[model samples]
Target: MADLSIDFVGIKSPNPFWLASAPPTDKAYNVERAFEAGWGGVVWKTLGEDPAAVNVSSRYSAIYDSYGEVSGFNNIELITDRSLEVNLREIEAVKKSWPDRALVVSLMVPCEEQAWKTIVKEVEKTGADGLELNFGCPHGMPERGMGAAVGQVPEYVEQVARWCKMYCKMPVIVKLTPNITDIRFPARAAKRGGADAVSLINTINSITGIDLDNMVARPIVDGKSTHGGYCGPAVKPIALSMTSEIARDPETMGLPISGIGGISNWRDAAEFISLGAGCVQVCTAAMIYGFRIVEEMKTGLANWMDSKGFETIEDFRGLAVPNTTDWKYLNMNYKVVASIDEDKCIGCGRCYIGCEDTSHQAIDLKPQADGTNKFEIIEEECVGCNLCQITCPVDDCITMERRDVGQPYMNWTQDPRNPHREVTEESTHEA
Candidate 1:
């Protein structure tokens, strides 16, 4: 069996799967159950100084797919509503009991230096492994000059992180928000302030959908609604892109990452690690399915590592970072054409309709001799966009086949078609 344990930024855990600071880690009861279920670590839910931050009745909304499965989730809930002393006591007790498991406290107080400094000192006595600065909450917290409000300003992010680093003895991981336009800015700011690592991303600002009958948005409270923080499977692409952006940037290079957002299984965790994350955090998946999901995540990841000849998590961590690059560096001469298997085609006409109406007119419907309709791709017109394959009902019926064009590598910077090619060449020659 491969070793699943990881030592992330000096905090060692049995595995890289930690529960994100959400409802799942809101209390000692939930965190204890998650530990028993085999999760490696837990970042206690965001704790703040506000004890009067009341929660609404209908604080959640969800987006479901055609089959009624939750594709995305939204929440207007605030941070931990419990008192500061009670949360601190629970953290101490939990850390005492589970000494081996990583217990990092997540904190968000008023943006003042004194407020942050005081909380950091209080949490340091809890015997916790580390602290995650929660500057990513997008919903209720932002209105009070916290959460995304602090994250949106790079200067504030740097200043707050510096305060935490100065006052706290343990590792400081800054949890960044995805609500900003450029994630790299905040990441670089965190690095400048001496953070041990950075975790991302916080939920996106979203209104799941409106209620057609009530003429109001979902999760309505007293016939009114406000935009909530959106998360879950739908946000995975955005999260992954941001993670990759930080991982590959020259300025933020070598900075540790604690990947969060939309991670549900072992494969998702592995992908994040490959993209340079030292560990991964999960919340929505555990909310939908109980903590038992960690069992599968552990077993699946171990089996995959064994098959790939990886003896430890570090063996494959950040393996894909080098391959991630800017768009201009992509190979423009690589060609691929769509091919359809006639025997497996169900004649759904979905591919034909999609290609003809929305995509390139590559696939056409033909009437066979036995009065059956068959869809065939036009070799000349097919751009290998994979639209037909995505729309096709039958799996493996449509596949894109790569064709060797035998052309040398060419990019926009050096391509003859570019009007600035002459200037680019002249600059290069001068250098």
Candidate 2:
């Protein structure tokens, strides 16, 4: 089997699968179980000092898919409700017991130099592998001038990161919020402040659903609701896009990234790695399925790696970065239209109805003498869109077959039909 181990910014883990800083890593008890269940590392839940955060009794809501499975998760929960002293002691003990597993403490405190200096010194005493600046909590913490409040300001991120690096000897990783306008700003700030790595993307701000009866948002607290941090499968696309942007950004390029968001399996982890993530983190899956799920993620990833002849994570990591490009650089002349396979077609008119009703009317339905429905694509009318392919029920029944349009490759930047086309910064990617 291929090696699953990773050395991310000097923090070595048995594998790239680490538990994200969420409810799963709140205490020593939960962490020990995760390590035993084969997780390579964990970012302990965000911690604060003196007066702790007070959380509501009902703290969670979820969005379910048509089949009734949770596609998204929302939470108004704050930082660690437990005292700082107890969390520090447990972290010390957990590190001592699980020497091989990565234990990086996640922290959020008042945006004061002395406050950060004091906590950095104290957390270092526990012998943790590193520290993750909790600048991404989108809910309660922001109101106190922490979390997203600090993250939204690039200056604060750099300042606090520099403070930690000055006081603490361990590696510093900045956790960035997704609520900001552009992620690269804070990422570049972390780099300027000398952070060892960057982890993303913290949960997005969202309200999962509404309670019709109570006239409030879902996860109602006393017949009331407020927006919370959203995660789980639904946020995967957004997370992937953000991670790619940071990995490919000129200023922050080559900075180590720990990918988090909607990663439920080995395939999701692989995608993140291919996009230049040094490691991957999980929370929603563990919350929904328990710790044992790591067994499958570990074995599945290694097995796939072996089949692909990859000896280690580095063999395939960042393989997709170069191919990921801006829309203006895409090949405008490339063409592929849907092709219906008679062998695989189940006589389902889903594609026909979908395209005729909402998309280009490019498919024809014919009734065969054998008492079966035949759906065929109209070659002339097909505009090469994949709407029919998307609505098909059976896999491979509707395939997008490429055609030789006999046209030289041309991108949007050089196309004659573009009304506002010009050679500019975005066009520089064309070559």
The top-ranked prediction according to TM-score is 2
Each model's C-alpha lDDT? 0.91, 0.93
Off by over 4 Å in 2: 423-431
Candidate 1 regions exceeding 4 Å error are 50-52, 422-431
Residue pairs whose backbone atoms clash in candidate 1 = none
Q: What is the Cα root-mean-square deviation between model 2 and the actual structure?
A: 1.5
Tens digits of per-residue lDDT for model 1, 1-431: 99999999999999999999998998999999999999999999989995646789799999988998788999998899888899999999999999999999999988899999999999999999999998899988889999999999999999999999999889999999999989999999999999999999989999999999999997899999999999898899899999999999889988999999899899999999999999999988899889999999999999999999999988998898888877655566778999999999998888999999998899889999998898888999999999988988888999999988998666656666778754344333211
| lDDT score for residue 129 of model 1 | 95
TM-score of each: 0.96, 0.97
Give the 10-residue window scoring lowest on summed lDDT in candidate 1: 422-431
Which whole-number lDDT from 0 to 100 does residue 182 have in model 1? 97
- The sequence of per-residue lDDT tens digits that candidate 2 reaches over residues 369-418 is 99999998998889888999888889989999899989876789878899
Reference-based TM-score, model 2: 0.97
